[model samples]
Target: MGEKPGQYLLWNELRGDWCNYDIVGEQYHGVAIYGLLPDDWSREGFETQRMFELVPEPANPHDRWAISVRADGKTVGYIPRQDCQSWANVVRRVAASGLIAMVPGRIYARDAKNWDEWDGENDPPREFASTVQIKLGDPDGALPINNPPTVPYTMIPRSAIVQVTKEDEHTDALLKFVPGSGYGTLFVTLHESVSGRAASAKPVVEVRINDERIGQLTPQMSQRFLPMIRHLASRGLVTACWGDIKGSAVAAEVRIDGIKANEADEVVLDGEPVTLPALIDKQDDPETYALPGWIDMAVQTGARHSYESQPESTTSSTPAAPPLPPAAWYDDPQNHRMFRYWDGLRWTEHVAPKVR
Candidate 1:
């Protein structure tokens, strides 16, 4: 009656025929008849047959009224209603396995079957699954990506030469020679630990010769003395000798030799007297003095005036003129009378009296 509730009939365009089918349950019902001419089929040919036969006489009491279709009698499509409740279970399994493909704006027959296959090659190979091919800009030559190498150094020898000696009780240290490429210097180092501490911390004597300075314990002394040594050595006077005296009084006397005869008059020793020969050697009136070392002592008289009366002659021959008041009465500034009156041991307080 109403198209047998769930039975369906259709024309196959590829096969070119009206097909006859019944819906019994999940399985096919009575028999399917195909290749029916559309003009010869009754208006409700298969639908009228299924409602009376398969709907009322199912294989089991619960077998639903359903429609099944076959391409060449292998059942491929179905629809369920009424007595076939298990037909719903078959439709759910087909939907999960993707038996149907839905496209928008298209309609499909209720009994259309979906067939699709999946081969395993669309996935990556197991070994290379974790890797990917990344394209860098371009390829260059293979260069090392690590560290570099090392170099070496050389050493040279120093050039200054030095020597030390003892002259008398003092030390005569020398900076003998430096190389021609001379960095001309020699440092004289005295370890204070080895040489005992000085009795007086003050420098007793410090001297420098050649390119070396000796006996300088302080930095200020070394700076002042070392440059002096360099200057002296450059002048070719490289010898510096000194004497240390341990006595209460240290005196030095310098005797200048080979002095000219005229020059000797100007040489005055602090406490010594100048002799007559020393002075006469420098004078132009050489013949007026007897010997260069002697003094002329002869006395002369002046001519008398005849108009004046002469004194009377007496027995003592003028009474000796009272001894001329002794030559000490004449105050001659050039006589050096104070030296002449010395008694060989000490000076006398006597001075020659002034005379007109």
Candidate 2:
């Protein structure tokens, strides 16, 4: 059988022994960037942020755990040796699910120029090296589920779709029990290797309805999820979740509705807003297609308070200042005929003439 797309888990779920690492990558150790550095324009500017794609290089001679970082479709560097092992494992799991492993990275250089322009004899402008900073771990739980379930735990998060393989053998038996609604819950159990197959490194999870065996998770999947399934079994929790049965009795396929690698936690937003980043595609905007970027937006409104009525003082002695507004284009205080960009803090030079 062909390799099925791997299941996805939140960063927390992907944080275990094999892939639990976070570090700022070292770029100059082997001149990793070499000829791949950003163009002259970028080198002559301030720090630039890019969405870096992490590609695992199992065949790399120097380090089998090597992970190459790419930006704008060109190689920039590699994940530091100290963290690549765990990072590679995480990348594999993420890639198996058909999603690219990407993280935000900053490319910066000294003096904001390709080469030092200092002509002074004593303090010859410092080094001209460029470095990129990346963080693989999501320690603060900032990464949310791609498709959260309506009710947590009872069903898998909508993102994980588990299929019961080898359903051909059980099709006849499944006919009678298949409900008219075509939906039912299946109990998951990790069992020893099937009859003549090689003894698996980990136990295989079997999917069953009532007492009849329907099918089992593929060998590859069993190994991928063995860790979490074992954890639940150790806690004496019954592994059961919803599934949808489709196709005629001649040959039926069972697909898990949702599943989770870890148990869900209680979430309370209070009155604060939730903000998320998403990659956008605008048809009319051709530049966006050439350089796609994540769009950040507030998904909820904050609770209104009396403090909002108070005017913000540009110079205040009090340490407790109200939160800054989200980054956006607003009327320029100094330039009445134009609008400047506020990047959640100080005003930026980016501006547009006020629309009449």
Candidate 1's C-alpha runs over 4 A off are: 1-217, 239-244, 248-356
Ten-residue stretch with the least lDDT total in model 1: 128-137
For each candidate, what is the lDDT? 0.20, 0.43
lDDT of 2 by residue, 1-356 (tens): 12222112223322112223333343332133323344463434455543456655555667766776654333456677876764544455444444445655556554322145567555544334556665455322222212222221222222346787888888776666554434333333333245334763546767766546778887776665555555544544334444556555456687653233432211101111112122222123222222111110111111111212422221222112113443533345555455455555676776554322
RMSD of each: 74.0, 20.8
Clashes of 2: 3
Q: TM per model?
A: 0.12, 0.31
Give the worst 10-residue stretch by lDDT in candidate 2.
295-304
Relative to the true structure, candidate 1 reaches a TM of 0.12
